[model samples]
Target: MARQLAVALTGAPGPAHRVTLSEVVAQASALAVSGTRTLLGISGAPGAGKSTVVEAILAELGPRAAWVPMDGFHLDNGVLEGLGRRGRKGAWDTFDVEGYVALLQRVRDLPAADAVVYAPALDRSLETAVAAAIPVPAEASLVLTEGNYLLHDAGGWEQVRPLLDQVWFLEVPEQERVRRLLGRRTQDGEALEQARAWVHDVNQVNAGLVLADAHRADLRLRLTTRGDDSAGGSGR
Candidate 1:
């Protein structure tokens, strides 16, 4: 299924003016009733619209859900520069694997009645950590965690799979994804040539690895420039 097919066939509603508060609440309510705190892993190739989908989900579901993206665990640019990995900032090695694991464990074990657990967020412009951008209140029964490396096998990411109750992988057509990424870089002020080069050299390479890992997901969503289509398949 592709995005066009998804829009045409699924009849999923359009995005709201704000995030979907109700949907998140409903999902979390169900999970809580079952006495389970669900950890949902969302992964997509570069430019597959993962963030947009997640934002919509959160908006629909509202406070019943909380999000702790893997991005918050990104190694600061200064640290990456010291480690000689600045040029490969989004690469799998640039994240704090142990820290991510720790957070997930906390999400799984924390009592449901506690106040709020502050989580960090990534500041793409500064390429550093922004303390407490996401708050996981104990009342939030559904945890929507999204990032490219959720399905990656590198580092200790493999340990993450067992912790997730469900995983959703997004797939966008190669050409459209490339176009979106290039446009995003251009808008960020890179020269056209530099943006193109970055897309080709950095993003595309990482995308390849991400795509290979998509099959490991419980469901694969094909997101075209127009819409989305979902399908199920077994992991190899």
Candidate 2:
């Protein structure tokens, strides 16, 4: 796995730096299946398309992989309301970070003995996390987990980084990312203007926090939509 820093940012972005998804699949395959169960973490700001990338990897690898989304660790809406944080539900503190860490450790340790280790998954339509909704089978070589906070350093999130065998951060152009987020909000029943407001005021701020920690990633993935929607990444 590699991290990409634009040549302009580090000096001249490497022309030979172009990468494809096959390389990413090969890299992830090499990491986890080579031996013990490995956790592959994916981090990105909202709308950076972490889910899309994770799905692509699973599609490429098939049954050799399993998935656990950090979004599944979101505290209940009632808990958020009790904490007076309901208005900003996607914020880092809104999640059950402790529970999430514990689950990851269990996923790594127990899958070999347990027929399957169950993990929670968040349902956006219900706006809640359903417990034990996903299963990690014993045969899975790599477990892929994605969220907005894997590399985020503050608020006990540092615990997450150490648990993952490798972490990749997704990057997309800011304006386009924001657009995708707004579209998502619209699908959730928000009006166009309301969606835009939410992205600009809330989502983008969280995105900045996530991006700040992108340097911690083993890989920096650039998913360009400008052309054939090809994916590429670089090593740190």
Residue-by-residue lDDT tens digits, candidate 1, 1-236:
22332332234322211112233334334554455678888787778767766676677668877898888999988999999988987888988988888888888888867567778898878769898898898887788888888888868989888888776676655666777887788877889999998888888888888988876776555532222332111100
RMSD of each candidate relative to the true structure: 7.4, 5.1
lDDT of 2 by residue, 1-236 (tens): 23343222244222223345555566676766578888999788888778877777888888889998999999999999999998788989999999999988887786465488889999888999999998888889899999999988889898999999777776776766776887788877899998888888889889889988887876676654335443332110
Residue 71 Cα positional deviation in candidate 1, in Å, after optimal superposition: 0.9
The TM-score values for the models, in the order shown, are 0.81, 0.85
Off by over 4 Å in 2: 1-18, 225-236
Best by lDDT: 2
Local error of candidate 2 at residue 150 (angstroms): 0.6
Clashing pairs in 2: 2-219, 2-234, 2-235, 3-234, 3-235, 3-236, 7-12, 7-13
Highest TM-score against the true fold, candidate = 2
Q: Relative to the true structure, how large is the alpha-carbon lDDT of every model? A: 0.71, 0.78
Local lDDT at 173 for model 2:
68
lDDT of 1: 0.71
